[model samples]
Target: MMAGLLGNNVITQIGILVHDIDKVSQAYADFFGVPKPEARWTDAADKAQTEYNGEPSEARAKLAFIDMGSLQLELIEPDLHPSTWRNYLDEHGEGPHHIAFFIEGMKEKVTLLETNGFPLQQKGEYTGGRYAYMDTFKELKVLVELLENDK
Candidate 1:
């Protein structure tokens, strides 16, 4: 079999899709003994609507960005309608949804993954970085993200 997406990059963040942002955020804060994350809203999040799996939804996400030493944690809660987060929450219940890996040459990496037969499930850019999600998780069973930090 072809080698899996190759790299030893450090995991920069863990995205947790939660049904109750407050509760979840609080729990993490308590567990880690750190103050709660400062909440932020971004149009970047709204763009995820285009990637939904036709679950008949209106997608809105309020995100809280938390800093845990050098690592970042994102707490996401979807609003009022079903979404990828909502679907993941429904199927798996509020918890770690994805792990992001910091990468170099993101577009080239995406090309490599695609050429290796693992086409992207979604690709998008946000304020601090660009991200590509590969659907190889179906067979590989792990949500893999190749992230290019723009900072």
Candidate 2:
């Protein structure tokens, strides 16, 4: 078999865009018999250093994370901004957006994906790490998110 770009193929998270986080998070909690995860907003642009299509962006979103043992489910309600989340929600309505993989050497991995046909769509920093969204919809049927956490 051919080698994988990420070395490992374990999916860490699945992200879904939503119009209303409160309702959706609660619904998921009810369905799963788990406590509703608290919803919160992403960091400010200054802190997140968010970029879309290579341009700086102030896009933010309300988010909630549901823990499902080995996998995580993320719900996002984007603001009226030009971030990747906003673009995906506007273009595709509320639904699954991306599958995420946690990785190291983010810059190199991002470059590898871009060189291999998957282009970078958006990227940003968070508290303990950073994330990049790859435009892989045409090939993989869903966008891909690369998350690099501080170790």
Candidate 3:
């Protein structure tokens, strides 16, 4: 059997960049009639190991997650630092960011994407998983994120 380059096309989350995560999170919650999830900041640079354009960066973002069925919606408000989130927000104001997928072999998937013209943008670790953002906006019309949770 054959598989797609990145293995599968299952989208797990959709990220949105906003000016204020707290306000946006509340708006989304009120619109959906659900409790507003608390917004929190990402780990520090040292802990998250955040990198932007192949260099270490002190980029951080306030984030909140809202589950909608099997898919999740992520709200991001980036700080004044160099990162994919910050760049996109600066260039395009505020709106949708990326669609995310959960993948197993993060290294291999990132390499495959890079080889296929989707360069890795920013990457960092969270509490239970790590994530990679790929520069697929030109071709795919939006960025793509790969999430790898520790087993």
Taken over the whole model, the C-alpha lDDT of each candidate is: 0.69, 0.95, 0.94
The sequence of per-residue lDDT tens digits that candidate 1 reaches over residues 43-114 is 444463334442323455678978887788989886655555666768877777777777778878878888
Candidate 1 vs candidate 2, TM-score winner: 2
Cα deviation of 27, candidate 1, in Å: 1.5
**Candidate 3: where is the Cα deviation over 4 Å?**
1-3
Model 2: ten consecutive residues of lowest lDDT: 1-10
Candidate 3 weakest ten by summed lDDT: 1-10
**Alpha carbon lDDT at 134, candidate 3:** 97
Number of the top-ranking candidate, with lDDT as the measure: 2
Ranking by TM-score: 2, 3, 1
Task: Quote model 2's TM-score.
Answer: 0.97
Candidate 2 structure lDDT: 0.95
Error of 3 at 74 (Å): 0.2
lDDT, model 3? 0.94
